[model samples]
Target: MVPKVPIDLPGTRYHKARVAADALRQQLTQIIEERRIALRNGRASAEQDLLSFLLSNGSDEEERGLTDDEIKDNIILLLYAGHDTSSSTLTSLFKFLAENPHCYDQVLREQLKVASSKEEGELLEWKDLQRMKYTWRVVQETLRLLPPAQGGFRKAIKDFTYSGFTIPKGWKAYWTVNATHFNSKYFINPKKFDPSRFEGAGPAPYTFVPFGGGLRICPGNEFARVEILVFLHNVLKNFRWNLVDPDEKIIIDPMPLPLKGLPIKLIPHSK
Candidate 1:
């Protein structure tokens, strides 16, 4: 959880954060205005992207369009959801793979088998990603160990009882990823880096929720899986790397990160 700071405290990190946020808001406002002008001039298509779609479809016969503030807020949310989380997960994946040589070898072998079936210099396709079962399992294990977002805030829709405790309706709750991911009831020997846990039926439903669950689950989960797998396949096909600091500490400042930014010495495969 991110600790709250006094935003009014001058020269503090919180002050800097506020300044940066203001600057970003200004930038987004400018971009939105420019896009609005472009849309009016017929220089941009309404179907181009989410921003364009929102701009185009927001207004209707009886409803008003989203305000600039609303659009900026949503854009920020998407930026973090679609980009930051995946990057953090990828960072943790590299660290885990490097530490577990056996697991790394298995991932490399699986990725290579998929590559072998493709023509040289060919790009990976959806079917190719589908074939990377073991690699995806390894990624799942990594997520179990270190989920980027940790948890999220949710409100109870109705009173519910679990473990003899009653959560009253209208109460806010935070569901932690590690709480379930690390529970021995859901995972055997939870601390161990074993991807085989995902084999067959996998963990009980809602037990392994790195992308959240139910209606509130992240929409980009599949996209992130494809992104991570494709990146790993390409990197493993051409290079092997060793961490410069084998025992580097992982610190979570909202999201997990290697203390040293995970410097590595890459060893390219000989042609």
Candidate 2:
């Protein structure tokens, strides 16, 4: 059965959503404006220049590339999912690394090897992403333990049988990544966070979907991966990190938000 809203009004819902979205847009625009002013005189990198030029100075065809509504929706969607998911995932990854010294040591060693093998002497390149397989495994394990989009709801289009239970048509199903991930039947050593589980035998595409599956899978997963790895690479290279408290509890929510903010201490890497 679909969960019924206590107070439902179709008109009121859109109106409320619009008002909230508008307020958020205003706040974000203000923050962007502030950053623009701050970086106005600072040495702008090529990437920054490219981003500013592309968003601000549009060509004639580019202007028509996306409608005002499309642009607004995409930008808003990016802000909503892109910011928090990546941050929360990164935080979880950090916490995992801090708690598991073997994992940390392995990552550090791999990063150092990567650093040494950079022939281009560039910070990060598209090709370098392919070489970070172990790092990718680490991320996969992190998602298994702390998936950013923790839970979601789906409505059955027709009657379905799941686990021998008949789900009636139009029933709303509440599902969670955490609930399925730690199942012993689905994973080996379900409680242990081991990146190697993904090495030879990868999870079924849809079974371990952090970014959903099929066509609805996040379009930005590749983009997200690159960004995450880039940020992690720099942080790992420049800093020696340790958790303030190793035994702290990890609390998961529907949003995959941490109950306790990951407090890590980073000292400059002194060799």
TM-scores vs. true structure, each candidate: 0.92, 0.73
| Model 2 lDDT per residue over 29-53, tens place | 6744554455465644325642344
Per-prediction count of colliding residue pairs?
Answer: 0, 0
> Cα lDDT for residue 168, model 2?
98
Query: Residue 225 in candidate 2 has what lDDT?
Result: 94
Candidate 1 runs further than 4 Å off: 1-8, 11-15, 59-62
The number of the candidate with the highest lDDT is: 1
Which portions of model 2 show Cα errors greater than 4 Å?
Answer: 1-22, 25-71, 119-121, 165-171
Model 1 TM-score on a 0 to 1 scale: 0.92
Query: Which residue pairs of candidate 1 clash?
Result: none
